[model samples]
Target: MLFVNSDKIKSKPLPSLSENTFLRYFSFAALYVAQGIPEGLLWYAIPAWLAMNGKSPAEIGSYVAVVGIPWSLKIINAPIMDRFTYLSMGRRRPWVLFGQLGLILSFLSMSLIADPLNNMSALMILGFIVSFFEVSQDIAVDGMAIDILPVDQQARANGLMWGSKTLGISASVAAGSWIMSHYGYFYAIVSFSLVISVIILVPLLLRERPGEKLLPWTNGEASKAAEKIQLHSWKGIFKSLYKVFFLPVSFIMGVAAFSYSFGRGLIDTVLPVFTVQELGWADTDYSQIFATANLISGILGMIIGGFLIDYFGKVRMISIYMSLLILLACAMSFLKSFWQNDIFVTGFIICFYILLTFTNIAIFASAMQLCWKRISITQFTLYMAISNLGLAAGAALLGPLKDLFNWEYVILCYIVFAVVMLVAIRFINFEKHQKRVEDLEIKHPDINIG
Candidate 1:
């Protein structure tokens, strides 16, 4: 129902970047991979490394809580992105490039820190800075996805983007664990810097669209017609945020987003500690099972889940997946007694990971559906920020819960969160809200209402 007015803006030949689906998806995947590596290093590899180095579970939890603050606070950066742009070089590219540079510097700084064990304070500060850059890059990459991908392609794009990130995290965990095990912490940090250097090249080389200005050397001029187009005001940004947060359907979607990953966060924090300290699993063993094998299943889930959401509808897919998650959580909690049976434990964990990934893909694709293109980055970031906050809250609780009740109650808590997630999905009438958005966009074609 929504239409683009070809005459309003200058027409140019379609660039290979946009015309080729493979190129577009590849670029998206590469950027996402760049984002994921450090995330995996900090969240998974670092904690395990710290635990192995004799840091208490509580200490590691505090560190993770501090590092995760940037991601949960991304709502603050989203509006800044929406309010400003270097349009001549593509709206989102400048921010993306800036974030990537900051990440490189942050990683390099971490590698320079002399005594990681004795310098926990310095390490935590550096980790927070690294996460800040990573979160910024995420905001820009998401904005780029909204700017380029068509509505029909968004579901698949979300899957590939997230799947690629999973792969990156898997690789980071596998490689980081191995490197730190055989080599040392310094070398491991250096390896992360080297890998990120390679991945950052993807966004550096590619333009946002055909004929967009390149930084530094290019004249940085927009087409005459493009120059005449008025940018949306701050009032418009506030309006879009209001619509997403205040509308009944979108409000429910936000609540569902907040609930969807709460259990995963608690489990993610506790499981590594339990596997390493309690179960006597080595770092490599944990990485191989949870990061590598489980994530491979997650990649399959993402691919399958993407198609299913597009075909069956987002609400239906989410409902089914969340219900499955509850059952899986209950079963896993029951299986905790049989932790000695490595085969059973591994299999159940894999199933849970797959379902988690599947549900996440579906939920994010639904969030994308709710964003209006005029302020896509800000709106979508707000939804994801809420979700990240829930995850952080769950993670922050892991240590205290473990101290009080041990692993069994932790798993029980996950089951309760999963039930709440399912209940939240019931109130989201995405179809009705989407119809309203589409009708608004069709009426005012110049303004992106959805």
Candidate 2:
């Protein structure tokens, strides 16, 4: 059977990812892997390659900071995605497809760069453009996951998603570095785009709910489940988003998210330049080390991180992990002599990644617990946006900080930024926020925010 509207058509529905627990995990993981490939290429390989080629830390740091602009603007994109969509085709699927297509187009555009090193301005612009689409896909997927996954499953699913992303980052960084070194950046991006192209099929084939449209052109209608929560107007969306976002606990989480990443961003920005320039490691050597760290940690994530978060408690786990990281930062800062030892350096990076992964799983899961479903897109994206803004500021600060102080002093500052997260975490009362949302949902039962 076929059905057509005045202007739109949707195919007969397929099974929703929500219908199968396995599908839920697999689909999200697959899409995350897609996210990681390009991310690794842009965030890791390209930057490292530039460093290896003699680019200054200031140049590289500023470039990365600028390219991250789109992610920081997820606050803007969230409302639009939440409010506007062909509901029949699934809420987030449309944006996911759109984002992936834009990513591919922007990726291919890289080939047009005759000389990437010489055209740093163009590189930043195009990278910004790519990040725009990347954030779109990211928010849509996050909202969808919140809507569909059961609470008990969220921690575990997050583990799979992050693990998948790490695997993709490892592969692309390792492979992209090799490709860019032997061939060119053009080949590296083009090859990564092809993998992204393959991943597009995952969302395209998996519907959010049964009886919803599979595609715009096929005969289908919005699932009853979807229509129940779909906000009818922009005003309703914003009103609902504001109602929940201003709650005290939600605001604290945002603060914590921001402060936590600033330290991470500082460390991230310092790594390549520090390793390659100061420590005498080759660019390839650094990338391989990074890839190896991600590979081991990704497996650890898939095997244990999620389960631990679920079993031990999300916030509690995060607190413990934060303490470990602060100690590691102190150790690394004081042991400047160890900086030259390849084994010690590699171990430090890997241990940091491992601890960070455990806490990140918890942190993300905690954030998801606070979302008012009706405004999940905006609220969750805001937390992520705040976190990224911190990361961007940290990255941008690195060059100036390096010029002003010794490496030990620079490393010590991370503890300050990270300690803010510990304090913020101490104040967040998830039950308080959840209870408030519960009360509000009862008061406005018609909105289906629950």
Candidate 3:
């Protein structure tokens, strides 16, 4: 929905990412790609593979539920990240490096399991660990991006970052599935871990801000910008967060995002199980098809999604996207006979994913727009956590719902979520929030409140 590059931050003697547009985008995109690898493996590949191996929906749901919990709970990390950092090394870089290393270590640890199907509990614990690290890395990267990127570059950077992540997920899912099939899980985990290991080079190689340490041992001092803005206590952050987030528009946007994500989460959980069990596609085939769909969606998203969102307006595009989602759900629910046609189901999956990619861009744009920028990191993280919480709820509910209802009934629930999203956003008054924040900015002209 937005791109991020800095024209304001001038190039230094040695240079930093904030000063180098090409390196800036590359580093951000590459880090997100690293973010997607474990996500593809832990969230999509492992669960789908489990379904292929004859795991029940309830069991699979449990795994996703446990793993996804950490992401939703990551709101706490935001305040901590805001309050404490090694400013000499850049505000967020230390956390990014820490989280990236944790991701690699956690990915490697997944290989230690001898028999995954039998060791479901261990799988859940390790999955939880991996997700925990991933979210930490995610928050740090996003915060750094928010600080580094100028408004002009946000739309393009957003598309590229999203596309890179999608491509990474697609590639990892395809390769991970194949490797697990022939070479086994150990090699699959190791290979992806190795790929993620390559991402660490980015942070080590490029600085976030000029004069910031590339490593802890290097000589550098905290930038005046960092020192001036650094919070002396949590009280100020929490106070500002309360004032901004409780505003009517901000609250509604959070609700809208959650409801929207809930529907998406349901679809994600249902697809792998439904395609393999009912549609009769092999696990590897389903994985490959899913990967292919994501591959296409990623490309489309990067090429066109951002430009359209900026041109069309965020709220209008969001409503349109949600309507299509409702219609798609209706089609899937009512047309039972259509499921018999392999071409139809395949087409449905591809179309749904493509639409999802576009819709997400719009939603992201809205979230970015709603942010107060006073405590923007914490505020944005809160919105994201709410969305993730909704996703977790949807995933957790699937197994129970499947036990009680027909497949059609389950898909039709998407209508409820879509409707809920529409209603929530209808109450959002963006200008109202913007006006209030403007008042705050007037009070503190010296600060960049936005």
Best by TM-score: 2
Poorest 10 consecutive residues by lDDT, candidate 3? 441-450
Q: What's the CA error at residue 290 for candidate 2, in Å?
A: 3.8
Q: Which stretches of candidate 1 lie over 4 Å from their true place?
A: 1-17, 50-63, 181-183, 219-232, 263-288, 330-342, 392-431, 438-450
TM match of model 1 to true structure? 0.80
lDDT of 1 at 364: 79
Across residues 1-450, which tens digit of lDDT does each residue of candidate 2 receive?
466575665544446787899889999998899888878887888999999899999999988998887866788999888888898988778888898888888888865788989999999999888888887888888898888888788899899989998888888988999999999888888888888888888888888888777878887788877777778777778778778888899888888999999888999888888888888899879877876777888889888999998897878888999999999999999999888788888998999988888888888888898898777888898788788888888999899998899888998889998899998898888788889998877787766442
TM-score on alpha carbons, each prediction: 0.80, 0.83, 0.80
- With a 3 Å backbone cut-off (N, CA, C), the pairs that clash in candidate 1 are 372-450
Per-residue alpha-carbon lDDT of candidate 1 for residues 1-450, written as tens digits (9 for 90 to 100): 389787887845335355577778888888888888899899989899999899988889988988988977788898888778877777777889988888888999988889887788888999999999999999988987876776667777788888888888888887998898899888998988888888777777667666667665764464332233224577657765675567677787777777666777888887778778878888668767876556776588557767887888777887898788777767766776788777877776677788778788878777787776667788888888788878888899887888789677777888777777788887777677778766655665544222
Clashing pairs in 2: 9-216, 10-218, 10-219, 11-218, 11-219
Most accurate candidate by lDDT: 2
Candidates' C-alpha lDDT:
0.78, 0.85, 0.82
> How many clashes show up in model 3?
9
Deviation of model 1 at 188, angstroms: 2.9
Q: Which ten-residue region of model 1 has the weakest summed lDDT?
A: 222-231
Candidate with the larger TM-score of 1 and 2: 2
